[model samples]
Target chain A: MIPTPDLSHLKASDYETVYEPAEDTFILLDALESDSDTLKQLRPRLCLEIGSGSGCVSTFLGSILGSSEALFLCTDINPHACSCSVATGLQNKIPLNLVNASLADPLLWRLQNAVDIIIFNPPYVPTVADEAWTAQADRGIGGAWAGGKDGMEITNVFLPHVSALLAPGGHFYLVAVTQNNIVAMQQRMKDIYGLESQVVLRRRAGGEHLSVIRFSKTLAVKTAVFHSNTSNNEVL
Target chain B: MVRLITHNLLACHAKGCTSNNFPLQFKDVQIVVRESEFNPDFLRGFIPKIEWPALVSSSRELGDTSLSDQLPEMLDDAFLKTLHRVLFEIHVEEGVMICPNCSHHYPISNGIPNMASSVTLLIRGLPYLASSWLNMKLANDLKIS
Candidate 1:
């Protein structure tokens, strides 16, 4: 089982992180547990953690969720991030498939429209400059904290791919910070690929708090279903 | 490099398109429909942000309309199923999309679109097209440099 994250040494500002257990692990668990649907829907099978910072999120989910039931595919654009996450998953005995893949690559993996639950704890601290970007936070955002500037960069690129990877009736839980242009960011989220969203969790610390937004994919319209046999020939 | 899905995210509210200047029409239409799996989760997650009228109409124009005119009151199993096919399954293989606003045309051939516009002409018809054009550049960077 994953070691429960200790929030004793951390503050809200710590949430703008780069794969530290002090921050990410706590938030992921909070996001999963507080949200009933996220907790229930993400039970088993293929789980894709898009930005597996240090693998804490995936490892925690794999261990806490029961490793044997679901397999975790931990992916990251940065090699360092990928190694860290992979190391954690391996050390924790979590069922993880570690890969160095960008969120936007269609050919990165064999999972083409076949993932059950999709999760992203992307680089919400957005930045547009490469020079100012951190080597650690280069998952996107150029490494500086400018929440709105680059939050959607990954979202926009990865949004379409989520449609191609998510299994039917799957759930996608992505978290981002709303420092600026929250309305525009919210609108962008709403408009892309038809995600219904809600801010389930928020933290207030050091005069700044982050909100956790969860989005789920609904079943398509009735007209598209054809006759298929399933006592429960569950195709997910 | 523009995709229809990207197109649907756009509206024609440029400098001059005020009346009936919407549902950017696709011209010189050529399309390529590629089969990508239907991830209902993503689709379901995506519905709220969709401009219902825009998505449904634009999708229909491309001959794959499935979403209702109004955002359906119920996200029924049946509705979700149809939405799966229309939103996720039906890929825009080929077509030319024209903005109903500035009469600008964005063409999609081989599942790729020519969203390139000169700086001054970027706002000629649809500013949304500009973003879509930038996205196409990013997508192109993924391969075929």
Candidate 2:
């Protein structure tokens, strides 16, 4: 007996469609909750999501956090997302602060290490120009898949920011496809910042399985490693 | 935990501040390497939202410069492993994010960016107070009007 979600469609820059979530959004939200619970061993206190296609993810998150004494902020680079989030919040009886902003902007947001969890379902498959690139699918320019060439460009931009929003011990869940060069991406994540991350879930379809990645950040605040010689990369 | 995402959102716009005061640059950065299993799918999906050159150069600046100039020709495990580490595993625990043009420095204390300097704080808070004061002034103006 799920409550009806407020539905609305927020349009994106071009060729990108923002669907205000109704039903399908529930399953995705369920997936995120299920995955997030596994990581924290309980429902978290704070949750933030980006690229929320419709208000579904936003709705789900709001409800989950609202049930707890928590806060939820749903942001999308698309204008449509901003509107949909508002409506969805009202429909679901959950409170949400909607932000219509892209990932490229410097986050002036005040939430610092306050988020206990972060979730994203990014566009993974590269658009071949011939492939159907919808507003829903084309999360970015060079291709519908946000990260260019290797589907990590966007993730790279996002990873460090994830740390800022998370608390001392926080979790991040990201979903993607196998087409993005995985090996190199993993290595880059490892060699660059020394944060640990792994894929916790996978589903196969037509030789492709949707993959879910769950990552956690350690206390990276500078004072944690003041004695280290080079402050730039302690433990390097 | 200053996220590159957060970094992209900040600009040093103190009073009369202008110039390329954006994309707060990283400095005195610290990188940590922790290994987590790889997920090719996640990496693939995340490609759409990235600032490619910023990521490439930032990684290089932080000293995890293994990512080649181009995407890997193949999805070989060895190659993906490296990419995975660089893209996800590394962490910047401490540093200052400085504005390239305005020389505005956003300090990253404890992996969290102090997006505010005292100047920014006073500047931002003052306006709210000013507005409230202005409203009071407006009430007085009403008497005159």
Candidate 3:
């Protein structure tokens, strides 16, 4: 197993503002690890991660895909998270390009249909809408977990853009809790954007039923016809 | 720190500010070149995906003239090395990325670029407040400037 990126440089004080990696982060890492073979086969040139709190996931990804093989671009709403991400990349010997932007705002247009891999571990804890709003505005550690109204307020805004941002045959990974209605989300993506999803990994962490769902654009008729059974049977 | 590879993917995201916003102009950029292991295969694969003109112009703005205005018809080791240096080796330690259309300034300090706007700060929570407040602030800031 690939070891987690060394985060020895960060301190407790840093966690006060930046999110400290937790179970959600680890689950995402595990999901990526399980899919490393497919990811390496894709030969991705660009990988974008949204809300890269501690930069652990992207750094881990760098190890999986050789450090120099793909350009790792990360975006974080919190400025402190952005700084910590840069430091973590440095510590792990991966050149992570960080943008202090909210939810890939500055990158959407330029990266149209170009990004090969997209990962978002958004704030998925159910909370009052107002609290989520405040957390997002605060742009601090709170923004890492306060998911307003079923924990999908933030994730909802980004869903429509996934199909636009992902290149054909690209993969997108999303982390969600049971409260987020995993099955419904997968259906919506397939219906609206023609992207098929499979729950790659799931675990009951504390009170949360965490899931890592991988989505990819549905291929043309010939390929889709052949893979239909395999994809349908992949529901786990 | 921000690098050209990252910068190449960035466009201005200010609300209602869209056209001619790409290839953010660099101002007072403090760049450092750190040598990295060269991988020819990766560079070769990435060449077709690059916006050649943007890469060339942005590199020139950062004071590297190794790449010509035109993408070379042939891909050779020497050219790949130059491409590798301009794309990965050079780092923008400090700079201000200005939007050509809106003139929005995205500052890079200690190697990280702050691309968040006032609208983005509040849009997630208070969309109504963000729009009204953003308009007022933009008007006030524009007047002041």
Clashing residue pairs in all predictions, respectively, total: 48, 87, 1
List where candidate 1 sits over 4 angstroms from the true fold: A1-18, A22-25, A36-42, A104-112, A128-150, A180-183, A221-236, B1-145
Return whichever of 2 and 3 wins on lDDT: 3
The Cα error of candidate 2 at residue A124, in Å, is 2.1
Scored by lDDT, the top model is 3
Q: In model 3, what is the error at residue A152, expressed in angstroms?
A: 0.4
Better of 1 and 3 by lDDT: 3
Candidate by candidate, in order, the iRMS in Å equals 17.1, 17.4, 9.0
Chain B TM-score (each prediction, in order): 0.63, 0.67, 0.83
Q: Which ranking of candidates, highest DockQ first? A: 3, 2, 1
TM-scores of the candidates in the order shown = 0.49, 0.49, 0.90
Question: Chain A only: TM-score of every candidate?
Answer: 0.71, 0.69, 0.92
In Å, residue A203's CA in model 2 sits off its true spot by 1.6
lDDT of each: 0.52, 0.52, 0.85
Evaluation by TM-score, superior candidate among 1 and 3: 3
For each prediction in turn, the share of the native Cα contacts (below 8 Å between chains A and B) that it retains comes to 0.00, 0.04, 0.61
Residue-by-residue lDDT tens digits, candidate 3, A25-120:
999999999999999999999899999999999999999999999889999989999999989998999978899888878887777677889999
